[model samples]
Target: MSGMHAATHRRSGDPQPVPPSAGRPNARTTVTRLLCVGAHVDPAFANAVVKECIGEVADTDRFVAPSYGYDVLPVLGHALIARNRRRYRRTAILISPFVPVLLSFLGMTATIIGIALWLWATWAAVFLERLITLHTLVAHLVVPAPEGGRHGFDGRIPDHAALTQIECDRINREQDGSSGLVYYSGYRPFVGAGTWQTSSAFPILLNRANDGILPPMDDRRSPGRAEVAPFTTAEIMGYIQRRLTAVLQAEEWEGQRIEELEIARRWYRTAIGRVRPVSPKDAPLPTEQGVEHYDAAREYLCVRVGSWDQEVVASVFVNLDVRGRTLYTETHRYELRPIKAAYHEVDRLPTAISPSDVRLVAAKAVVQMAGEAIGAAVTICTFPYHLLLRALSRNRPVSPRDQNEFGAEFPARRADVLDYGARRSVREIGQAPGAHHFFQDMDVKKYGDIVQKRVSELVIDFLEERNLDTGEYRARQATILNQGIIQTGSGRIVNTGRLAVGENASA
Candidate 1:
């Protein structure tokens, strides 16, 4: 979204911008519908999204968790919307004069008959049909319903926007406006399936002619030639931040486009061990404090480009350090891929109800009802085992807060007690095996190139303003910028001549 076609004429080296949402046939619709009905259809996926995306942290608190893409609220609340719509239909049908009531009665009878066939019939074919039906239903729900309802998955139908705002406010209040910092962990929230990709460093040495001939720049009175630049790291950082922000946060030319992409700058906090920001609130620190940390190499510039309603986020973290009169610019770009494929099953159901819709819904539900019956039978059979396990298990239901207050040995705040590598990323979980066409491979490359190039260019510009010789910087920039990713025989895309690779989940 940042690199629209109109901006292409601005610079020669700019990556041509393709429509961000292209190559996605009914993908957004399917995803939105799935989001709405996932709670009832696929409880596990719904729960994970709600916990990791909507809810800041998982119940078992260790690593920090935050959503990176797709407004989780609209999707999470889709179930509620669906439930309300169902309630309304039932109400209307019950109150109708005769025709609708009769139709509703017939539909209900047919559904009941379909369920009974699976639950009661002992024939192997019946059982098999039930199994297949349940499998299909578990994949997605596509119930036939009327159009233009109060709340629906149609793009025209508005979701619970006001309610979503209230819910978000409540969550913010609960967090007390401070996001947690996960210390001693290499895993990051929403970073898709790949190692963190880093660009070749661009060094700005005092004497570009002789690469490694300079003494330590830390000393005020070193034996060398010229004085330090008339700028501090903080000043240059602020300059870059402002310039980059102005460029990326373009005003929407298309008036109807809501939630235009915005650029935000935040301090990339770090410690001796691995550390990452769990929530946006945890990202920012006071400029003075941030500069202090940056001087000590404890912070980096986190330039984030959130597009498509934050469904896709490209974060380029730029770390700058001055060592021995050489200003080193190291950049790492992390991307959050589109939502999972399982959630895209909504397209199977069209907007309007048809004969096929009824058949599809009925067929899918038969096995699901049968599976419920089968599950009940299993629960009855495992009663004794469940009881034994419950009695033998030492783990009791106690909130961490309550346990700590009641004299628990380990403090709940102690994150280092038993560190687990990353449990799962909100974006990574339930993701499609490979990058979906919604976030096409081309789009990924374009976004990365534009963002990374802009960041590097800004850094070079900042150094140039300080009267630094950028001969080496320009040469390094050409090499690094030209090193676009290429696909290999295994279908994996890697940086040309570098180990850094894109988050190709299939690979």
Candidate 2:
């Protein structure tokens, strides 16, 4: 995780001095999907790991599906440690009985140690209770049963949200002391509603990104939502289109049916409108004024490739791309999620809690007696218990599953785990819906007026690529550069301007 955080911070501007994990720029080499029980390798780092895994996939002809849930190892380790200490109790219990026999040989030392072990056991009982209380409290926090996101409509950012800059800067700072920008806009997309599998093409995305097989960085400083740099919605969609084009282009495909085609409004799914009031505590302050309710549903554009295409999907969610310092430093973040089936495999109980407390106690008692009565021969019993602990964890593989089921029902969980990306999108997708209803049903080919002059070239470049005539394209570009919206579709692209001025998600 530190490696993932440091690698990106080096790319952007981060004040925090996070030590990069071993391998530095070669983070791809050190990728472990789930490094430990609870610690997850951010997709940024896991992408490289996936690339290495993909070669194995081809050889095995099996999909490495990601899995998610509470890791059982941490508490399991705690249990094991607690169990190991019982050996001391076993020593006291077995030796005390032989006091009449051993007093001739060892005297008071043996008696004193026995007394100490007994005292320790009583104290350990209290310690064990404390550990249980701690475990129970932490469980309530992690278990979605009593949380905000159980039904997937919790609206909280997914745990893996740390894969991006906003995640690192915002969340990490939130951890230290400072407060992040407050949002008041109620621009909820799902409305406490469950969404479908989001990105089916995650495996492919990770495979490529890890292999450094990504779209060449042609442009980094894209204009964003701000007062001076008022970027229009079309421009944002254009970037998404461009990124998608690059992803589709890099894929190794056998089809010749559609090699290249202008991505139009039909390829996107979007919803933007006014809703109810959402306080700043819930909604961040809107950058643009006249936007009243934070509860209003905001912009959401799910770019769709050809229907049912099992391809990786990516969201290059940008906060600001200013050339600050160098014009202004912009935060360019990307989240790539693959679709997998294992996300549906819900882990109901904590598997680590399987070790029996009574059994552990009993085993320790037997070991001490056997050791005293039979000397080193007690190794035979201790060896088996060591193997048992290993068996408990080893029996449950942490790596991706071998035989994966694709297109599982979406759980709408915000948790980032194996197959989560796909689960979200799958739940939302079944039959492809009508023509892409972008933020305002804007016609991409119609070439609307550009709103940002600094980004005019970008808009023009975007328009030129789409299927647009020279006359219509030039006229729209001129109008748009001056901050005007052209009547491109049956209805003009209306900027409800309801969005708050900030870039952070709602509280």
Candidate 3:
């Protein structure tokens, strides 16, 4: 992740560990496959598409799994499983009695009575320990330390094999069959777990000055006609990559030295409705091999921008399709919001754990601990039931036929199987808005515009090189480049080459 600054120069190579997927939460029932998160987590109700595009991320897969914000899973797991060791040990001892009763029918009544007594005591003890641990840690981790004005909370999480195993298992079970490898290479969705933002599309007709629009496929019947064209679509794409990378990596301004600006080929998975009429019966292909040959709808030149120390990430996916005499190009952007305010509270914590701070935290946590104690009991008691459910439940399979139906695969069942859109933002889960500066938002917009504009210019260049008339393209390009966000009573109107008037309107 620290090496992100070089992403632009080393575009072809892996820059960081492939991001890890937070194990999908367990299925609620045999029929239901996903958790219904409230508006707090995912305000947009994004189609929950799979985030792991390259299939399972192995430990050896080198690429940064940039976390948009704080992930409570690791912290909570470490705190409850590793720190609360004594309590779990006692719980095991208590549950041991039930094992004997179930296995051997000897002294069943006596064993049942003994089990009941031990269970109650163990449950009470675990509840108390868990409650106190949660409260105390919250206080110590949140409260201001004695020495430093800034909180002393440590971000470093020590390596623990068990924690890693738990996280991997949880993520795999929930993310089963959501891999891009299972679908057409061009249908790979955005891999980052973030929110969709603004987008832009530019379609240019490739016709020379004197010659009117020419049907690209008109020569199919006349094999004698030479395939004379200005330039192949791939050549234009190569030009854009080279030119865009140069522009981004240029040292022309301050606060513009980007840490992560990755430009590479990625399969751009669009909604089922947006997917072009590609064959559904064809076997899926690996995206890296050569998805460019697939429909333009699925392949894209993804430009990733990681700013504010990777706290804010914006991805611009550019797709270029040359069909007949028309060059169809579109750019879709996605943004990952900042970490939650609560995680930032660590800034207010003391530099070191002090006796006085500990005592104070313990005192403040007492009331909250009481309530959490009850929750702990329930969780422990229902462990068997939940375990059983997980054992019996199967992760639904994604149907290839469903891809042909517009919005058909988007229903609950299919979405649960394939949609991996982010449900909750990091800020919502942490119970606080991101502590982002106004400048950060401005920077995000600036970067997106810079890359998008460059892309448009390169397309024009491609046409120019072929001696094609650039009049229409230039006119549309000027309008598209003159994009502005106008605020209205209803909401914000984004004006581009094509005016999108709705409050929710995006390119």
The number of clashing residue pairs in each candidate reads: 1, 44, 28
Which regions in candidate 1 have their CA more than 4 angstroms from the true location? 1-34, 37-41, 53-69, 79-168, 172-186, 189-212, 215-227, 248-261, 268-300, 303-313, 354-356, 395-430, 484-507
Per-residue lDDT tens digits for candidate 2, residues 426-454, read 11221122222332113221122211222
> Could you tell which candidate, 1 or 2, scores higher by lDDT?
1
Ranking by lDDT: 1, 3, 2
lDDT of 1 at 81: 41
Error of 1 at 48 (Å): 0.5
Task: Give the CA lDDT, 0 to 100, for residue 217 in model 3.
Answer: 60
> What value does the lDDT take at residue 221 in candidate 2?
30
Q: Rate the local accuracy (lDDT) of all candidates.
A: 0.47, 0.28, 0.46
Worst 10 residues of 1 by lDDT: 1-10
**What lDDT would candidate 1 get against the real structure?**
0.47
Model 1 TM-score, 2 decimals: 0.57
Query: What TM-score would you give candidate 2 relative to the actual structure?
Result: 0.22
lDDT of 3 by residue, 102-136 (tens): 64465777667665655554445544554444443
TM-scores for all candidates: the values are 0.57, 0.22, 0.53
